[model samples]
Target: MSNVSSRVSLSDWGLEPAVDYIERVQRSDGLVPWYPDGPADPWDHVESAMGLSVAGRDEAARRAYDWIADVQHDDGGLWATYGETDGDEGAHAGDEPRKETHRSAYVAVGVWHHYQCTGDRAFLEALWPTVRDALAFACARQAPTGEVHWAVGADGAVYEDALIAGCASIYKSLAAGAAIADVLGYGDARDRWLETRADLGEAIRSRPDRFDRTWESKSRYAMDWFYPVLCGVLTGEPARQRLEAGFDRYLEAGLGCRCVADEPWVTVAESCELVISLAAVGEAERAREIYEWLFQWTDDEGVFWTGYQFEDEEFWPGDRPTWTGGAAVLAADALSGLSPAGELFTERLYD
Candidate 1:
């Protein structure tokens, strides 16, 4: 409603170093490792790419998408995890050996984001097949009750339960995919994706029990708490109330949002995402307030740390994740309305 300013040029929101970190970790194939020798997850890789777009590195973003397309499996799935640059860039194993459904779907959001930033119709046209295939990989596993499953393995088996965080992200991917279809003149296909999006949103709001319930409950994770709002499946009064109910659960007044509700840790990324989520629900003042607090977590040189250990009053993980910087850039963009991709986190793309 307000379309307010977020005080950009004053700080660049530490994007310079964040961009540096993203570039440092990015392999020649455009695959950005979470850290050097780290397992590159698809969604985190895309977030880093989106950060590049926010910083006017459009070509980097496109190449990031290209790397995504290059490694995608024929079944429309990307590995839930990828090896380090020195190792096989396409090999899909990590600290664990399972695959995730959301990893494949996130490419849609990246493709649409690149299009929004560059207005590159040719780029969108080229990636349409990947978008179509990835969404199908995710959507085919949606339960009749409306929730999509969390991940699939290389063996081509489905994990029946859904993750609220993953599903919330997939919801955005679905909306973005439908929007992509609309741009490419796939009218019938777009309608189908729109229908699927609505059904999935209904499940997210009306059926939280449908997700990640059978396993250890993941409600402690802050992403599951705010993702629906951040992703636009929950908005307006519903979104505002959802955050209000959970404020005490994850928010730390002077630190940041917690990775887990009960943990006294504050992640720069989650804090940044909550800022966008607040703005999405018309809580712009609160959004800005949290955004201001986030700078406390950055380094002397500007790159943000992974998270702070508030209880110990120290840095917890001892790593400056590139995606953490990406989150800060995106949050600033959302608060300032600085770029086309700013609203990528704040506003709903589909009605």
Candidate 2:
């Protein structure tokens, strides 16, 4: 057990209210939209569910995971975005449908995180097929160079361009998927996921040319800078160096992390995820400090505002996303060791 929890009181940090906000945003069918009225995306949906699991709201978390099972397409993927209702002029309505491989595969991480928090082997077993199919769906789209294609279009054509942050996330998902397979005694599945993950990781760490091939470079985004570390694709001293190398470019002192290198806007979710990444590389003290800087943006109701534009000196977009709150909860857990999976980002779970 780590004494990291001694450094900060999770309750004092507003963990309860953060969890409450996530639960409140959750719809009856367990959909966790970006906000009360915003559309739901698969990756953020899973991130919020992970927060529910960390807060000991296991049943609520289960419902969120169940939402994935309910909405998953037969191809083992969900559309890139989905509105709360089908006919409204909401965020995702009337948009061309595409399935992001990273989003589709993220269920593995959520399911494994849920199992770590609860130690429910039966639950893990129940979700195993979903995990298996989702990983397969992702792997099926991988190019020979090992970067998974970012998406499949509505016409079922593969989007050839890959994203650095997205591929980093897929690496983590494949790790979780492999862990699940190992626990269930599926040796062959475990081996396959491990093999795929290794190849994907090599592409991420060594072959920058593979990503951003079709679009303008996304290197300006903070996620592209740190997600490789956050998702455990980069670890040890190299992970620490990767974060340090880009620290000044992304961090805004006493505010939060910037969404992009050129922007003065600092997003709560990005800061929280950065906190976890810092902790992942044995920088817990700095991680704690960064995590503390975030509470100033929490509203009277305890949900975090989407982001702040320091240049305009206002909360931009005026939306408090459920996934933002979820990221905060997960960051706190990573620092304070509040749940069995508290070290989820700090340490590797599978082998």
Candidate 3:
């Protein structure tokens, strides 16, 4: 799968089914479900919009952005889950629940990404106050040592845990916030957030002990293997060597990236993200190969499975995930002549 000669075009793969899936979500109200079987999540909706945008479904993407804007909380935050309210007969029945702060911060990155892709300054301006407040909310939860706490209660209290995934989200949010501030001409705020980002990056690199021991205990999880390097938080000879070594340890020929070295199925999200990471480091050839593998995994419906669960003999047993679509869109954008050249990470590479 890593072979360079195996490149394939997105159009050659017959995208009609994927287009239909995107259209179904777009025609409905703002709610987009993670799977065909479960409830909708705002984060997933944002991701779907990104995928649509990549596929040039501009109108559908715009609708998704509008839907998210409509449902944002009064406190400048968003809920983790939203019940189906699109008036579809026989939709899954359940109570909609909002997550704590950590999840809320994750949504901001998607919103910011949408704004960048569309150049919708008005939409971005409308979201600015909410985005700013959310950033402050996230920043306030940062520990003295610069690592962000895991979550904040609805009552607005900090909940700390140092989960590696949450840390990745925090890094992403801060970077997105800095971009938003720069766009909005909030010079001081942009600098402040950038400084905060630098602090967090340094903390993560210098104090690996602060992270969960489980992250270090195994080299199997694709995220633990690639996220740090992909995020621009890891660099230099040692970092690159670490990633290369891990790739040899965990990468399989035809199955894509395994969650664990011994795992059989490839996780769509992890594989797509790995492509972005590879591209970020100037390995475009390898990134292109991974991109092809990812394109192969998409079903006829454009819905990507969560993972190939060999244990259950299931391929994405649940519904198509929003993040899976999001990863695909983001990676495709990067591959389709869209470079983060003037962005934070690109600048850091030369610095």
Candidate 4:
């Protein structure tokens, strides 16, 4: 399949301001919060770090990873959320919370992406141990049915239910983990992760009964509908078909993608993810069209808003998140090939 390339460059989007926003919100200890005085989550923090890599803020990106490495628990997990920074320093880890598998596993994706952007083998080697432990932490949660349990509570109670969207993300993280292991010459680790990933893909494709067993169906969410494709579990014609089936239900015409099927709201993050997913299955024109729709939603500082509530015809939530802008930057990179890791979302890690 041909890689997608945008007609416009990253310069055309004028995302320097968005990069500026991420830097401005980054704490002294390297945690990237949702916004100033907002909480930080590991997954979104990693996403923002990827944006820093794409925007030539390599040092900032490295600092972000270092912080992630520092905070990982001995069991190789991290709390789902961290309190906001206290005066430029990171928050204390006194607040114990549940750890989500996908959130803990995402470091592999960020570490691999940073390597792709920089080709810095020394850096990759330095972070290899952290990636190894993180994937180990996540894969240990996989059940015999091949679905991973979503989280474990602070009191050691496991949340046995699985989420399609979260598992699909873990599928991709496993692929990235395997790739990193291969590069570092850990053949045993690489093979193990590959085996786990294949089983997870099977669960995603053929084992619908395994997910959301204890809760209501999550079919209304756009992520659950398209994430398998975004994460490379679905490809070629099958991937394209899955996206087409949900187009009417999730896409908001020229605006963006709706976060949920029944909501009249459009989110920049989901829309940007959709762009990458569309491009993954060779829908270049369609991806570019959706990409154009997001340009009008940026603030005066170029930071994209959280989402727009179309019923009210206004940008709701009144918050601009660093991760949302990060998603936009990632979407542009996927289309424009502006960075070495531009195809990170478009290509499967292995055949």
Give me the candidate number with maximum TM-score: 2
lDDT of 1: 0.83
- Model 3 worst lDDT window (10 residues): 341-350
In angstroms, the error of model 1 at 228 is 0.9
- For candidate 4, write residues 1-351 as lDDT tens digits: 335444555677788888889999999999999999789899999999999999879999999999989999888888788884333233335544688999989999999999999999998999998999989888989999899999887677888989999999999999999989888899999999999999999999999999989999999999998999999999989999999999989998989999999999999999999999998998988998998999888888778999999999899888999999899899889888878899898988885
lDDT of each: 0.83, 0.88, 0.62, 0.89
TM-score attained by model 4: 0.95
Q: What's the TM-score of each model vs. the native?
A: 0.94, 0.96, 0.80, 0.95
Of candidates 2 and 1, the better by lDDT: 2
Ranking by TM-score: 2, 4, 1, 3
lDDT winner between candidates 1 and 3: 1
Q: Which candidate ranks first by lDDT, i.e. highest? A: 4
- Model 3 vs. true fold: TM: 0.80
Error of 1 at 303 (Å): 0.7
Best of the two (1, 4) by lDDT: 4
How many steric overlaps does candidate 4 have? 0
Sort the candidates on lDDT, descending order: 4, 2, 1, 3
Clashes in each model (backbone N, CA, C under 3 Å)?
Answer: 1, 0, 1, 0
lDDT-best of 3 and 4: 4
RMSD per model, one decimal: 2.2, 1.9, 5.1, 2.7
Superposed model 1: Cα runs more than 4 Å off: 5-7, 84-96
